[model samples]
Target chain A: MTTKFTPDHEYIRVEGSTGIVGITPYAQEQLGDIVFVELPAVGKALKKGDEAAVVESVKAASEIYAPVTGTIVEVNSLLTNEPGLVNSDPEAAGWMFKIAISDASELDTLLDADGYAELTL
Target chain B: MAEVPTEDLKHTPLYERHVTAGGRIVPFGGYALPVQYPTGIMTEHKWTRDNAGLFDVSHMGPGFLTLNTPSGDAETDHAAIAAIIEPLICGDIAGLKPGQIRYTLLLNESGGALDDLMVARSKTPGTLFIVVNAGTKEGDFARIAAAAGNKATLKRADDNALLALQGPEAVNVMAALVPPAADLGFMQFGEFDWNGTPVTISRSGYTGEDGFEILAPAHMSVALWDELLTDPRVRPIGLGARDSLRLEAGLPLYGHDLDETVSPIEADLGFAVSKRRREAADFPGAQRILAERDGKLSRKRVGLLVEGAPAREGAEILDALGTAIGVVTSGGFAPSLGKAIALGFVSPEHTAIGTKLQVSVRGRSQPAEVVPTPFVPHRYFRKSV
Candidate 1:
């Protein structure tokens, strides 16, 4: 599955009407060793670019932004005991939540891998 | 851009190296040191815990105190100088053998700690080498100088640079550079040469591991650091890991764990006070210190393991009923323990191990328990060959 990334480092993988949302590899690298992750509850609705979750490191905490308007369908429950998964595999197994897309057309607004890399650089 | 007061921010010789290594420089103890590398604080902290980490602590004050005499015969009166200096601190300075190092505290007239420092008795009889906190070094020097008053001379070794190589593999990595250093026991120091540069190496470190603190000439620090980095076992660690490592080892940072207002007795640093000094009562704060040592101290420093989120400095410590009882002096998430821990000053009544308490962090009261320090077991090397 192709994953699109946002300028702010959030990534989204569209699967029909649902999307798998997580932070990008670059974001995880920058955030360092993840100690805790606070995922939004299932069924919670979020607007595009709204604060969706929280990821904490040893030294600081950061807010995760929603890439598109959606309702949370699933949250990564493993994060409570093994937040380091976000650092180890931010792109794959470290996916934060799955969302039921409210606006599939909004996916066009996000950046592809190349564009995300350029923005990061 | 308008200029602000940055004169207080001192830079070490390796400041540029830090920037190039992707270190996040921050002002600490009046010096600009790397708080974290590009990997970030958590990564650096975990790396240091699991593997060897190099630290650039060159900004700390490294100096010597020379015993002075009317006839310019320092060796003749070396014992007197060591004895005189001992009164101002709570270490067995007079009993320190040649090439011995001891962690000690500088006390005020009220028995409060002015600063906690490391003093090393060099091979030279009249010279006592010392390393003090960068922020309080000037004041510590002035206090010592004034107290010594012509009995000893305070000489700042500004040409030297300090580096800490810490973690379980630190000894092996450093041993490759200084072969004989591998056998040196903890708290023992000696002069050695690293690639033709004379260096003073101490088998002691803030991290709860077997490590060495190498003090070399400022010009050679960068070269040594680069050379150490070439080894796969050693990775450059920033100040962020250094702080967490020391905190996990239960070591106290100067301004946080100790201050001019907190006495050695109150800080639970009584081990530093020798029995001889206690009996003599000749030190500056001997009278009050002795009283506190005899169970008269009102407050005592203790460690706390907190539940929930991390508790930061200045967090209010509360009783079981949520009443304010004390304040956290230093608190943070301990990476190794995978939990939050804190050091705080509580009433002596609440200082016992396992005493239950609560800490208020971010407007929430979290349960905490009084625990013994070195929150993690210290892994200092004590073997002598």
Candidate 2:
């Protein structure tokens, strides 16, 4: 599985044509305690940079955008009850949704592990 | 988010302490203050509820309104000072016993709240210790000074550092640091010496917990802060936790839950209108205020239990039919309750406890219900009579 990241801190881990999405650990740290998470419907299609979800901290609400154009195949309903999972395990169990990649070429435009590391720096 | 120019913001005396403790600094009311420490707001909020939380609140305006010339008699001098300030607010200042504090509102001509403030009668006579919200301090001070004219003086004490130590263990912490403060009843204040420096200690705070608000010299702020943190029960909390704590307490924040256009009655602070002021019909906007009290009011502030996402300020409140009825002024996640809650103003007909309501959050209607507040019960230390 190869992972790609957006400058806005969203990450998409590709396994074949399916990609799992979530915020990076750095983004979760800056957002503080996650109190609520609003996810898109399972069948919703989102373009790159489209607001796909919302994460609310104790202080304010922040929008989470889609990293690449795709159709949402699944969403993490566990986030509704345990939003802190984003803060605790952002990459694995905290994955917000599973998307069916429509254009494989779009993944090439995202930052790779080394590129994302430098962008954060 | 745009970065607020730090150089332009005023720094409190404990600014260095906050930075050294790894606090996340933010601009609040034109002051550079910490929003949260490294431990985060959730932990700090829970700490304050369960133990003692030390907060730096020096940005608030604390001043003394004193009579220029005292009559030498306590009662006469107090009456003289009270008369000057009474015309501006709806509180029975003259009736306050020495060292007693009353929460009151500074009103505009049309009965809207200019600012909410604390006024206390001094034991020394002819002086009233007043504290106003930080954002409205400049205008509030100017207005009070103009009212005093040559008869009294308003000494601004915003330069001093103000600290709040709050929670169930607050009294125990004060008992160890300042023995006399432990005896103070809720809403009472007194002057005490801390390591030879005189400080004012009030047995009150915004958090729904037993606590004390201390006003000390700027130079002694660091030493005092370090001294308090030495106590295992005390933790340094930031403004983020402060806001959350007050919200859970059901207290109104001056700028958000109250403003120049909101009246005391509309803000659910009608209790601040003293009985004597209501009877005399003498305070500013008394006619409108009294009329509102008599059922001429249109909307009322109510607390709500939100079902889904937290309904932040400006979120629209809807009736059962999804018709707009009001707007939320303050809403967020309640750490103690582990659920979303909010304070908002809605038409009087829709404010009854248990009334079903909805909040439109980001174009989605979330289920909500009118509920009684102090979402967490207050644990004030009211001494038995």
Candidate 3:
């Protein structure tokens, strides 16, 4: 399994043909408190940079874009009631959705954990 | 055009204090102010609703309008200064009782709002202290100086710092700091000293909860702030929670909810125009503003109980037929109400409470209803018998 990050601050944990997607801690910190989340429905196909979801804090709402092209296989329905999970555990239990990776070679373009951390700094 | 550096942003007296306390500083109204602390906006907001929250509002305009030449008599000097201000704003300043604070709107010639401000009579001869929005203060000050600067000296107390101690436990915290402030009821201001620091406090605040706004010399703010936080009931709040608090209180924020094109009547701030001024209609834009007071307004500001996503500014307000009727000025999740509530302007026909409407949130229509403001009931402190 390999965890990759995009410059826009989204992360994807890749395992074979599937990948789990979520935002990085740095992004969550900038968002302050998360009050609402709207995710794309399953079977929706997204292109890289497409606005895939929306996360709202008390101050304002922001869009989360797709890092790689794929179809959404599953979503974190739990976020509908408890959006604070994004602030609590953004990378683990707070993962937004699972993407069925259409292009495995696209993972090579992403930054590793250390690379992303350095990029943020 | 060259980009402005963050270093160019002004810092308040509480900047270092906020940094030491782990506050997340953001650019706001030409100042680098804290948006939240390490505990985050949610915790800080909830804490304020339950306890006292101390806020640094030094970036706002805090100044006094005094009679350029006092008659040495309190009544005569006050009347003289009030007469000068009466022409610029829609308030009956001349009729204001000493030591009283009145929330009023500065008007344009078209009866539109220039800014909303709080004017407090200092109870002393020739003094009326006022506070205006941070972003508009420069323009507001210029206009005030031009309109009545000669007749009534406009003293921008830029050297002073302002703070707001808010929430249910605010009075308790304030009383511990200054005993005299405890006797103050709602909207009453008094000058006092704290550890020899000249301070003016009023039982008035932007939050719907009971609280007070204190102003003192800039050099004295840090000492006073540090001392206030020594009490467990008082925690430092940020501008993030402050916005939510005022929004929940249904108080319109200038530049967003109010502007040059919006009138006091259309913004639902009719009460800010004093009852005496309403009949006389002597202030600026009286012909149009007073004419609209009879309920013939084209649009009216109202509250909304949003069912789904939070509707932000510029969101479209639509009728049942998917026709746009109005636009949202301010909208957010009300922490106290535990739901998304918004303030917006709609046509007069849709102004009635319980009138069903749909707010287009990011192009998705969300069910909403016209509700009475404030989203959270105001708990202002009133004197006990």
| Candidate whose TM-score is highest | 2
lDDT of 1 by residue, A18-119 (tens): 889899887887766777787888999999999898887676568899999999999988887888899999877899999998987898888988998898
- Candidate 2 lDDT, tens digit per residue, B176-279? 99999999999999999998999999999999999999999999989999999999999999998999999999999998999888889988898999999999
Residue B182 alpha-carbon offset, candidate 1, angstroms: 2.9
CAPRI class of candidate 1: acceptable
> What's the distance in Å from true for residue B143, model 1?
2.0
Give DockQ: model 3: 0.57
Pairs that collide in candidate 1 are B90-B272
Q: Which residue pairs show backbone clashes in model 3?
A: none
Tell me the tens digit of each residue's lDDT in model 1 across B1-385: 1124545787888888998998867788778887788877766777777778999888788888877763445445557668667867878787777788888888888877888899988877788889888888888888778867878888887557899998888888977999987778998888898888889899888888888999988898899989999998788888777888888888888888789889888888888888777777777688888889889988888999999667778999999998898999888778888998889989888988999999996577989999998999988887653
TM-score of each: 0.82, 0.98, 0.97
DockQ for each numbered candidate: 0.23, 0.77, 0.57
Model 3: lDDT to the true structure: 0.89
Please identify which of the two predictions, 1 or 3, would achieve the higher lDDT against the true structure: 3
Write the number of the candidate with greater TM-score, choosing between 1 and 2: 2
lDDT of each residue in A53-120, candidate 3, tens digit only: 99999989988888789999999999999999999999998999999998888888889999998987
Candidates in order, interface RMSD in Å: 4.6, 1.0, 3.9
Model 2 per-residue lDDT at A9: 90
> Which stretches of model 2 miss by more than 4 angstroms?
B1-3
lDDT of 2: 0.95
